[model samples]
Target: MASLAALLREAGHQVSGSDEGVYPPMSHFLADRGIPVQQGYHPRNLDPVPDLVVIGNALSRGNPEIEWVLNRRIPYTSFPEALKRFFLRGKVPVVVAGTHGKTTTTSMLSWGMEVAGLRPDFLIGGIAENFRSSYGKGGGDHFVVEGDEYDSAFFDKGPKFLHYLPYLAVIGNLEYDHADIYPDLESIKLQFRRLVHLIPTEGFLAVGGESPAALEACAGSLCARETFGLDPGCDWNADGIEMTEGRTCFDVTYRGKAFGRFRMQVVGHYNIRNALAATAVLHRLGVSARDIGRGLESFAGVRRRLQLRAEVGGIRIYEDFAHHPTAVSGTLETVRAAFRPERVWAVYEPRSATSRRNVFQLEIADALAKADCVAIPALFRPDKVPEGERLDLDRLVADLGRRGVAAWNLETVDAIIEKVVAEARPGDLVVLLSNGGFGGIYDKLPAALAGRTETTPGG
Candidate 1:
């Protein structure tokens, strides 16, 4: 929504909004763009009555702003609806979607196209480090977007991707997610199938072949398709993967022929899988292999995807948006392979709607076992899920113990910090994971480690 606001503002539209608990990156992004934002929602906030209200999906019938808009009969539409109507009509929509790697795949594709001199406008879920923003206003035919399977506004219950009109869609990987809206894996597959059904016959669907669910979702795609992965049989495959201190080098092949040798600052097999999907799309668009390699090298990656928040007394602190078991394992595997640190500490916050539940309990425990030690705080938004559905922290700790991983289920931010700080050594790597803000622990933990009040995170 923040990225859309920026894009709308850049297009000379007057935009303002009211949302509570706005956090950094977005809060800072809005302020940086000079977008006025009311702290909280109230009827008075809409007293002047704007020309139109783009009601967010998070706001429903009970929201004060929604109530005011309905009571006054003010014009209103969902964000995706407005986006499709205003911006996507005459453009080639390149949507990257799935349960994981949407942000990275979108960012990678966006950056690669930009480097090839196709400045396609893009909107990613997180800030792409190469662009320094989650959005862009490039003068190109493509309108790249992160295709979210999550529902649109309350008025529109369909997935947001359905409204985007995808000319070229990339399904990085699909799995059960957004448990609040989706009842099971089949529900999500239904949405993806719907997305694929809209694609024109001339368009393409680039899918991750390694994930059986992703392959299953795209099974009925009517458009041209390419399977990308590290496996040799994939239409787009990467092999000879090598990881160094600051780079991951791999050889790409297309249908058994050498496509290119690519090197990137991104590491781990999962991220390499993300690269494969993006590379296939670029190739389909006629981007030269040389240009794609250069783009991969230049792409700095998205913020909070194993981003180094701070380093205090030689102990490195990294932040990642890895809440799912697959994502957690990928992140830990990346850090272990790339850094070779003394001991790694995995700090987690079961914050996402799905992660806070018991859906992936055993999977999450196995993923966290990759770390030498683990620390997790009380689940965020635990009240939203029924008591029977909440994640079993006690069982998780015991499971990690059985796997030889020292685990702690701390109750507060201070306790988590104290436990890690007391044991961390100079060469160790500590990664904090969450989809939402982990109660400002990123700042607090760094300051506590430095014995100071403020410490800015960079690189």
Candidate 2:
């Protein structure tokens, strides 16, 4: 939403918004753009009633502003609709969708297009480190968007991707997610089915051959389908994959022809998978293997995924958005493979709707157990999920302990920080995982770690 506001303001639109909790850096971003952001929604927030009321999916019928708009018979539409009508439309919308790696894949694709001289506009969920913003304007006919399966506004029950009108879609991978809206794996698959149905038969559906759900979603879609993964049957497969400290090397092969040996600045085998997905799309677009390698090397990655916060007393602090069980597991595996730190501390907040629910409690516990030490901060807004569905952190911690992981269930980030720093040693890697800000723990963790080291005796 902040990205949309910034983009609109850049395009000389009068953009104003009201949110229950207005916090930086979004609030500051709006202020810097000279846009008025009214904190806390009220019926009067829509007094001006200038244009359509862009309702966020988070907002419901009970919201005062929404009530006013409906009562007054004022115009209203979802954020996705606004984005499509105003930005996407006839543009070659390259949508990157999956349970994981959507942000990274989209950022990579966006950057690849830019490096290939497309100068494509993009709307990513997370701020791409290379772009320093989640959105931008493009002069070309392409627009790269991070396509999410989450539903649109409360008024629209369909997935957000339904409105984007994708010309080319990349299904990186898929797993059960958004437990709040989706009842089961098949329900989520149904949404993806709807998304793929929108693709033209002449267009392409680049899917991860390894993801069962992704394969099922592409089954009946008339779109030209191409699979990319480590599997032998895939149209594009990564060969000779290697992961080192700050760089990765791999060979991409398609239809018996060696595309090229590519290197990315990012770490992890999962990232290699993401690169393969991007390679499939770029290859379809006719981007040369040489250009793809250059783009991957120049890519700076998206924020909050293996983001290094600080290194104090030889202990490295990193932050990542790995709340889901699969994502957390993949991140831990990647971090373990790359850093091989003496000790790995995994701190997490079960804040996402799915993570907060009891859906994957045991799975999450096992994922965190892969680390040397696991600290789970108290679940945020647990009441959002009904009492019966809320995650049992106590049981989860016990399960982790049974798996030989030193696990602690702390109530706050400060407590988690103190606990982690008390045991952290040189060459250890502390990874903080959460989808939300977690009260800006990434910035605070480094400061606290630095302060503790300075106070400890070295003489």
lDDT of 1 by residue, 1-459 (tens): 888888888888888888997777678888887788889999888757789889889888889889878988999998888888878889999999999999999999999999999989888999899998888989799999999998899999999999999999999888888888999999999899999999999999999898898898899988999999988989999989899656899999999999889999977788889999999999999999999999999889899998999998788999999999989998998899899999989999999889999999999998999999999999887889999999999999999999999999997888999998788878999999998778889898888888732343541
* lDDT assessment of candidate 1: 0.90
Tens digits of per-residue lDDT, candidate 2, 113-210, equal 88888899999999899989888787788989999999998989888998999889998888999999999999988888888999998888899999
Name the candidate that leads on lDDT: 1
TM-score of each: 0.96, 0.98
Predicted structure 1, TM vs. truth: 0.96
RMSD of 1: 2.9
Off by over 4 Å in 2: none
> After best superposition, candidate 1 residue 382: deviation in angstroms?
1.4
Q: Residue 186 of model 1: what lDDT?
A: 94
